[model samples]
Target chain A: MRPAVRQKLKRRFAETLDLPPSVVLDQAVIHIFGDSEVKIVNHKGLVQYSTACVKTRAVQGLIEVGGSELEIAFFSAQEIKIRGRIRQVMLK
Target chain B: MTQLLWLWWQGYLTVRLRGAGIERLLNRASQVGVALFRVERLTSDVVLVRMAARDFRLLRPLLREAVNGPRISVSVLDRHGLPFVLRRFRRRSFLGVGLGLAVLAVFYLANFVWFVQVFGNQALAVEAIKTAVEDAGLRMGIPRSSLDPARIERKLLESLPDLVWVQVKNRGVRVEVHVVERDEAESGEQRAGHIYAKQDGLVTELLVLQGTAQIREGDTVRKDDLLISGMYYDHQGRRQYGAARGIVKARVWYEAVGEASLVRWEPLRTGRRRSRYLLTVGPLTVPIGRSLPRENHLVTSRTWQLYLGTAMAPVSWTRLDYEEVEWETVPVPAAEAEQNAYELAWESLLAQGVDRERVLVEKRAVENLADGNGIRVTVRVEVLEDIGRFSGQ
Candidate 1:
């Protein structure tokens, strides 16, 4: 019922089952193509959007992107594509 | 590829989203599976978003809560998708009817022959084949279905004795008539009797194939002179007539005479020219200039037209250029004119099929005209040729 207890029990169960943490823990998979495009799979939702910046929610933290003319090229329930002059990407 | 076309057919709209909670709107849109794309900030409080036009309808009810504080204004910047375009045509029902009638008319006109082309036919005139085609009811503007090509081919082959083969092909609105003409004379070249000089020349080489050589090398011969005799002498001093065959190579001279006045005319610009611009849409031509140019000037035009795929569209642009030319009299140099006359003579000599490889330049002569005003250049070309002929005895 507690947050630490649930996490410890899930880690023990994952170790016993020999399952990868990314799939078992619902971790987001991020892929970058060149310097202008970023594809984040398993994204939760869009947080903030602007021409200079975009923020999306990942499993562990929030994905913050700084760019010029940033645009959501495409998006669905599973993956989201951000395309433009992507300068920096950080998880905060 | 089909999905991309489907996206276009379903139509996409760039909606200007204006609200303080634009992020919340996007999150909610994605959560509800509306599938928004190409979202970018247009202004401080406004964001331009591209999404399916059909999906925008699902967001209308959700935006009702912010109607007073942050109202949304929707404007159709550009309309895409087939149905939206079709809806515009539906409003103008006459356009649909006119288009349908035009298509039907074009389809009807396609069944008739617009042009007829003849190919691979010699000896038998193209005019004759066209006449034969018309006789078979395959003339211009005739319906294609009324006559058969095979029947026409058969009838043409039967009517024209020279046609060895005939083919009638229907290409679009044009009909192509192909025919092969049969040879009339069989081995006519081998049967000959008299052997005469084809031109005036000095004999350079001579060979008798089946007759007596009448002229020897270095001997001058005139046109129509007997170069080879068609008669052979027997031991009893009697003459026998037969086909005379021989090869006689000779030096043939070609001469051309030309005269020109002391004064010549040269063309110069008059400095007064006119030009105009025109645009055409379909068959309608529209003038886009002050006025047409003056008369007596040459008119040339350059046109650019829009061709979509293989079909030429109605839109076109054209520019016309005009120039005024005036001829002025000038004095001519006698030596240059004489040289030009010599060049012209040489060209004419080559054009007469004179052998250029063995031209006897030493025998060439430049003759003065009797009037003492012009010059004539004669070119003597010595050629080793097969001058053979079968003279019947």
Candidate 2:
């Protein structure tokens, strides 16, 4: 009935069924490739974009990517591809 | 790279969005099933993003709605991919037509034979094989569709009885003909024979591979003289006769005579010249210029033909240059006349199968004619070569 109760039940079922948290808990999957690219799968939308930083709305919160020459290589309803000198990834 | 190609194939544009909340525009575009790529913030209020050409119309409403906060104006920065390329090509249709014609030319020319190659032939003359191939209708400039490799192979096998197997391959513009000649020994057609001297020579080297030596090295032999006898004694000391095989190399002398006149009539170009052009198709010739006088003229002609790669077309262009000449009596110097006579004699000696590389000695003799009008020169060359010729016993 409540949003917290619904999330807690979903996590418990995911743990019991041995399912991945990103799939069952409705969380964005962040994949970092070396230091030049970051792929946020199951993303919500774009929040902000800059050459030095990029932010995309994920299921949990805002996924912020910080680097030099940061670019949103691709932005779709399903994913956000960020490519640059990726130094840090933060959830806000 | 594949993603970039797909975007290009679908046609896309880079647009500069002049607004504060450009990310919202991208998010809205994405929510409406329109993909955006290469999003970069140029300044605080301006962002550049790439979207499919078809999705730009869908974003017009979104841009208009953003006017309430900050006027979001869109301007195309660049256009890319197939749709734009086709539009440009539509304006200049000649380029497309030229490209199409070039491709068609290549396709059409590929159907004609550009080269005829023969392979895997040993103990058979290349010219002979080429002649047989041409006789079988597989030659340069022949259409690939009309060529039946099976029929050509059959014809080659029939025309050249020595060829046991033949394969005609049509490789694009080139036709490759492969032939396997029948070996006499392998076919059990080896004959019992004696190796004899084919010409008069002094034997220098003798090797008995399957024969008894009839004459030793350094011995002189005449034409038709037997050098290796087929008769021999086997291991059991029994007399046996079979095919005799051996190499008999000898020093042979070739002689030729050349004569030159002391006084000769030489033709000199009189500085008057005429030009003529002719078109030749197969054996038919059509003159394109005025006919020339028949007598006292030296004619030099050069022929030009159309060729695509290695294939020759049937048509040819010929340019004939005629120079008027005047006959003048010139006295030949003794030394120059002798040199000319020697060159003539040497040419004849080469025609008699004299190996220039193997020549051990050369001698020249000059004799003045009795009438004092001409000089006769004789050339003799000695060379080492195999003089063995097999004769069936």
Q: Considering every candidate listed, which one attains the maximal DockQ?
A: 2
Model 2 stretches astray by more than 4 angstroms: A1-6, B1-6, B42-46, B123-128, B158-162, B182-212, B215-227, B231-393
TM-score of chain B taken alone, every candidate: 0.55, 0.55
lDDT of 2 by residue, B1-393 (tens): 898899899899999988677778888888888888888877888888898999999999888777776677899999999999888889989988887886576657666777788999998998999999999888878787899999999999999999999998866666789889997656432677788899899999999998799999999999999899888899999998888888999999999998888988889889999999998654568998887775788899999975656655545799999899988999999998888888888888888878789999988899998999988899988999999988874
Collision pairs in model 2 = none
Q: Which runs in model 1 stand beyond 4 Å of their true positions?
A: A1-25, A29-37, A64-66, A83-92, B64-78, B121-132, B154-164, B181-393
Model 1: docking quality category: medium
Q: CA shift at B59, candidate 1, in angstroms?
A: 0.9
Tens-place lDDT digits, model 1, residues B1-393: 565477678888878877586777777677667886777778877877777888887777667755664565545466667777788889998998898986676566666666788999877788988888888778887776775898899889888878888898877566788888885433334554768887777788888876678889999888778888877876797887666767888766655444444457676777776778998754569998656444445668899965544433445699888777767878767777667666776677678776667565524456667776656665545555544334343
Worst 10 residues of 1 chain B by lDDT: B384-393
User: What are the candidates' individual DockQ scores?
Assistant: 0.49, 0.54
Q: Write the per-residue lDDT of candidate 2 for residues A28-78, one digit (tens) a residue.
A: 999999999999999988777888888888768898999998888888889
Residue B141 lDDT in candidate 2: 83
